[model samples]
Target: MLTKDELCIQKEKPNIKDISLELYKEFSEEILFNQIFVYYFTNGTTMRIEFREWRIYHMLAIQHINGKIGKDRFFSAIENGLTLSDFTINDSIKNRYKIYKERITMFLCMYSALKEANVFYLPSGKVQNTKNAKADYIVFSEIGSKGMNIGLMKSGEVFVPMTILISKPSNKMVYLEDAIPMEVERLEIINIPIKEKEQDSEQ
Candidate 1:
């Protein structure tokens, strides 16, 4: 049984052979997960995506910056407005907006990947099972000794997961997993292709 928020391993298990020990050692260290731009590909199309900046937290920051939301009220909004109520942004976190933004973008990438795979994350973190349902997958970023760890989970098991290492900032597994390629003949930005300019050969 797979919950809508969860996913099973891909059918093409052949594509996911055990990573070499050398490769594993190479990425053993913590990689900075703060890359603002995420590159995604679908149906033979690739695009660069950036996270939307206008979030509730960003709004609170703006309010704080302008003195609209005072310290106590801003903290209240964070505690009440966000789902992860246990952890609120403190002064230490506030000073590191770049790191916070990176973390936010990481989740954005994870959600986008799950959506592309036709999997949905439930607002409530409860796992459920259905009969004869096509199993789906879950992608999540974990904070580890080595910055962020991206995991691919299937059927209560983790088949392919990687520690994001600064040595190799772009992990192909993050993009390639569960993406069914098609005959899409264009460079896509979030699935929309940019119009190209025609050249005059005679010039």
Candidate 2:
């Protein structure tokens, strides 16, 4: 039986229609359970979709248990899992795991659908302020018989770019927000299945 928290998480799960029914059908819970990493491709350009670490979900459950029922009770609940019927501890663990799994599933589905669509780079990480920083790629937009340079800003730590920009001849900069409207593209599902050992290591 699903706990209240698990039910809530399921209710908020991403819609399969948003990505596409065909893509969603490509992946199964058994397949996604074995995946270690997933990449999203727009046109030909690629970016890694950050998967929520299992440690984060585990830590969230720990925090919830500690805050709600205290550390001693948390340990007690763990030791007495067979007999104790504490909903708080069970719900927290179940809820966090549900979120962790759903996010990975959504990304995989979206990537499969968008892999062949028009490429628009989505930069990741912090914005660098150094002149020496080089852009991974430059996109051009035509305006009034002139071509304008749009640079992809990359972070020093991560190779993937996250933001879009518009540069004009007059040195004016236009920053585009990361929110891609739902209507922009229909997404599909793709899976990168890994060995059981590798999946266990990730957890």
Candidate 3:
């Protein structure tokens, strides 16, 4: 658990891949079984972002059955003082443990991919309509800064600031094209081996 004051202190930026892999290794079981898995990372700045995973596989299972991918998305909250309980969902999925493991694995993979691409380290600005009345750091697409004249932003050009909350609902993972609010037609896809055997074989 990270506090606001602790998050305000500047620290050296840890390798995103290392942090993600470590967190996955340490908390994989908690992520699969718990209602939510919460963690924090600092970008070598006075700001840190909160990452959360929620268990809502029954909804996802229905969406999967109906082929509805719209709700299968991540959420960005710019407000402060938000926590795991703030993002709530009913859980009643069949074979929830299995689905939870699958969804959490996919979610962590997508998260690591985005972090490697620096999607969460974008330009920072204040967001409106946030839960907290006070202004909070919000990360938006490059187009949001440069206007619509520039067309779609290519991969490696997108940005996100620290101090915001990014969350993934339990479901099939969607890439940045669907995750972020940008006119990105495609992003450079990175192949991340999620299984130990696959990693070992790749080595």
Please, what is the whole-model Cα lDDT of each candidate in the order they appear? 0.28, 0.32, 0.27
Ranking 2 against 3 by lDDT, winner: 2
- lDDT per residue for candidate 2 within 38-103, as digits (tens), equals 234434434333222232222223343334545334333444442222322467655654543333
**What's model 3's overall lDDT?**
0.27
Candidate ordering by TM-score (highest first): 2, 1, 3
Q: Which candidate is the best by lDDT?
A: 2
| Models sorted by lDDT, best on top | 2, 1, 3
TM, every model: 0.22, 0.28, 0.21
Greater lDDT among 1 and 2 belongs to 2
Candidate with the larger lDDT of 1 and 3? 1
lDDT tens string, model 3, 1-203? 32222212313222222232224323422322221112123332232232222222221122332222222231122122322222222353334423433333233332333333233221222223334312222222121112110011111322221122222333212122223332222233333334643454366
Model 1, 11-126: lDDT tens digits are 21111123221221122111111112222334433333222212223422333233344533443444345322213356544554433333332332333332333222222222
